[model samples]
Target chain A: MATARAADEAPAPAAPAFDVKNAFRNICGFCHEDYGRKQGKGPQLMDNPNSDDYLFNRIRNGKPGRMAAFGGAFTDDQIREIVVFIRKLKPNENP
Target chain B: MKRHSRKAITTASVAVLAGLAFGAQANEGILKRSANDWPSYHGDYKSWHYSDLNQINAGNVGKLTEAWSHVASRATRGLQGFPLAVDGVLYYSSPYNQVYALDGATGQMLWTYKQKLNEDLVAKQTHSPYNRGIAVGFGNVYMGTLDGKLVAIDAKTGKLNWETKLVNSEKLTVGFTGAPLLVKDKIIIGSQGGEWPWRGPIFGVDAKSGKEAWKFFVVGGNEGTASDRRDTWGGDSWKTGGGGGWMPGSYDADTDTVWWGTGNPAPLYDWAGDEWMTKGPRPGINLYTSSVILLNPDTGELKGYHQVLPHDAWDYDPASGELMLIEQGGKKYVVHPTKAGFVFVFDRTGKPVNVYKGVDNINFVQDIKPDGTLVGRRDMKEGKHGNLCPAIAGGYSWNSGAYSPKTGLLYKVGFEWCMDLEVVKTTPILEPMAQLNIGANFTFQPPKDGPARGHIRARDPVSGKVKWEMKFKVPPHGGLMATGGNLLFIPEADGWFSAVDAATGKVLWRHNNGQGHNGGTITYMAKGKQYVATVTGFGSLVGDAYGELWGEPWVSMPKDAGVLKVFALK
Candidate 1:
């Protein structure tokens, strides 16, 4: 009962300081490497012509037989954060 | 130094392991009797990569032309495997786990087997999903998937027979990159995520039910004989000591032994902050991490093991080397080319017979103990060690070396660059989904003496002495294929598929295919003529490992250009 009260009373956990650069370098960069400038296992995620909804759905649900689903692993907010980060990725000649 | 006695046999148990009753005679005969059939991944069980076909000789190789070409539908990454030609169809796998059966004579597709791996499965893969190739036996083509499934499909119909999850990818970040070896009735596959803190094992899945037949962990665990292995890890580091067997194992039908090489310890650099004097992330000679492990293919029982580099600080993974069976002076030896720049020769019983530097200026290993354990450079711990030659890819990596009985030489493609090692304080176990969990990182910087280069050497397997060597601008990426016609065929990173004289390492013929070759090459007889097949398009992480000091060819490769090229006498 006390723990429940504390949970109800405490402030919500703050969103993480999502280091987009480090996050890309660590995760998506392994395949859609060079800040998503070049294609790898997946197509280039930057300067993509797809909509936000398409990118978000694809990132979350993942295409069958091709990409993996990250919806279960990442929170909705986290996915949004990643999508926003990806949207800002600029295209460079050298990946 | 321990030995496992042979299993006491019973009629039922023998049948289960050997599959005497359910023997696929046709596939067995192709592997055992035929020289023209590229049945197994290493061509045959011998892992020689040598073809006895001499229809296209060095004298006439200049007339060789592209017989045909096939482009994979979704080959976005580098192609890293050869096609397995059996009967009249050539079976090849793309990096996306799609297997295609093409007409051996013509480049027409017979059937395509595409195994869909979801993002969750693909995320857990330790390396690129580029399967080396599929193994064929029992009328089925067996492949280990990036999602940790041992998938068997009907070789003719391309229908899925059975799919077995070999590793718990959800629990451990490990998957299969090696091709499954169809031995007897068992589909044997090994793990590939040692970098993700995987405790290694070679799994034998029952060919019929897809059930695990037996499992032999490279690093022993808390079981009967494995209890002794606990002391080797500092603290609980043994729980996730990386020693994955990423490459396929060689089957010795003669001794019933399957020889496999194991990868590096978890965290490429094991020491942390002055802990070299006290407690390290991983201490003691990390047993079985960088070694050639011999096992009884029937029971998955350990026969013996010989560690190539003990307490490996450098990422000198023995797992990438192909286990070679070379006979010297009437005695047989299991030769291994390691990332530590040495080709190690050992007797069949796991006794180290000889070890010599396969490349030039290997100063990482300062001394070698009497028992073959290396005394590496002490300064390599917890700090920047300048100019470590044969860097992480070693003298060679997963690109297999070929041995020819006719020439009595081993043809190896090796890198001649050195890298600077930088170790920083890091967590012990590789975090579940981290990019690199090691204590150190490396960047390619040329030695003070010369520029970074690659070499293809024809060396004596036993003596480790180079007979004749040819240099390349960048490291050659594919496996070597030696033919009986005094010609050596190898694929290069610079988009050239060239042939050199086997006796003298002279470039005899060359073809510019406009894409680099980073996979294995195979030769087989189709109809009455002989043909050579190899996949092109480079983009191995080894290419990404170097810096600008090397060259653009070393790092910059165009994506989605993976194509299989076939050549024969025009």
Candidate 2:
């Protein structure tokens, strides 16, 4: 098997521009469902009554037994972007 | 034609008989398990998931009552592990790597062992904490931890024998959630992959002393090795091709081969359409993933394989189903169900013998031929596609089906649902920590045939001839078990555990365990008394959708609770 590259051997590349839309599709949409417009595995996010701080913290430090923490995987700014995306979610006209 | 020649023939026959008996014993209680023990993950090497204990038969199944129950602590996503019984002791695992040894008849806790884990790493994982099952042999109980270690606990006394760190889960963010199969002297376990951007590796570890033996990369096979099929992927796409044998497979003692299934490739949905061979994110056939792999357990060598879905863009993994070893008309066939809702039958050599549909709504491909070719392929470009059949949750989930030799039938549960998908082009997340590489957003919807529902069907393993079926409002997330008592035990998602006639599909007995079932059901004999034990809880990755889809008990069900409920005749 190919060995995992050592951190020192390969310099870290620049972080790409965060695409919350595509990011939701790739990760959060699995449980959020319908781009957060509808409830599925998790509650619907489009009209969620929770505050933005609550959403950001929930995304960063996930609730135990319910969701996984993304603090390590995503930057704080990216998590805030996710909160904004959740706030902007609306029902798809086509759907 | 002399009297002396005839005497030599009789002596040779005796020697052959003795050889057969020794071979059975040499397998070390796996091939020929005792009536009281459920030693291996699939109950035996055949993956029968059936017990021969008939002390509680269909006639007296109505008198079955709960003997005792043991509640597991910190059952985050519930107790998903199957219990193993040997010599009146029941060994089971719950979430957070907690193992308990109980008296099979009394449910009295003898001892418990809790492994110290990297809690921070586990908290960051998507499929965290829940242990599926364990293996028991060589005076030890083997379990795979969520933090990427395989530990052996002494079976008689709950003490750590040894622990081996196999995967670099801190970097890759994926580890072992499935049980290890005790093949001879090696503990073979597969890592969780598919959606993660990593070459999922299945390891063969020394069972006696927790030492790393061999590893087989299911993604692009071992790097630079000929016949590893690394050429199946384009460029460096194989580096994160995402293939794993996340579930435990069975052993075929006749051929001395392990028949395991592999998960699908990363970036589950392809956006290249028909130009997949050259233009896709990870082009070529992506060999070995979504396939039935025949392996040499001792060396982790790929013996032969049949890719069930070539270029599987639907996340239809063959790894979810148990490879049921069935013999029909003198031909031994491995019957496997892919997540795409079709069943493939193969010979001992990994050659496809037959293909049949297990569920009704399957439009991912128009048809999968008996030769394992996908016809009328539905390759989606980067756009919205309507009503893709057999939704993201799959026509079949990771739970296993049961096959019974008594009734000559295979009992399986299948879901009927479709999805509205919008395929997106996403970049692989491989730096610092790996994340899910799903390339599509989808929502569950009812199939054209009817509402979204599930059914348990008893069918011929080779022919797919349905004998009978019982439909449910919601699918059962747990595994099924059949018995020689002519009863099929099904733990439903609505907290009901029922015993139905294996031949008739009639519910003979039912009991509510207060939560949805999402783990395993098993039967074993303890002190000459037959007992049925099942793990009950809720909140699996797929099962988490139950609240919105069917909103009654599930909306109010507890997710962090689990119990091992054992029953016997009153």
Best by DockQ: 2
Cα lDDT for residue B242, candidate 2: 92
Error of 2 at B559 (Å): 0.8
What is candidate 2's lDDT per residue for B128-199, written digit by digit as tens? Answer: 779999987666778988888898776656777778888888998888889989888788999898998878
Error of 1 at B407 (Å): 1.1
Q: What TM-scores do the predictions have?
A: 0.83, 0.93
RMSD (Cα, Å) of candidate 2? 8.2
Those runs of model 2 whose alpha carbons end farther than 4 Å from true positions after fitting are A1-15, A93-95, B1-27
lDDT of each: 0.70, 0.84
| True lDDT of residue B31, candidate 1 | 51
lDDT of 1 at B450: 75
For residues B1-570, could you state the per-residue lDDT of candidate 1 as single tens digits? 111132212234323323211234433643573666788888777788988889988899999999998988666557888788865568898876898888878988878998867656565343665777778766667888776778877666676767777777655655777887777767788887556655777898776566788877666432476324545555556666777788887877778888888878766675443243225666556677777888777788777888776666777888888778777889998888877777778888888888877777577777655357666554465656677776666778788889888889998887777766556545532333433345553555565567777788888898877788888767777888999888899887778889988999888899987877778898887787788999987666564443244445544566566888999898
Ten-residue stretch with the least lDDT total in model 1 chain B = B1-10
**Residue B239 lDDT (model 1):** 61
Candidate 1 colliding pairs? A67-B119, A68-B119, A68-B120
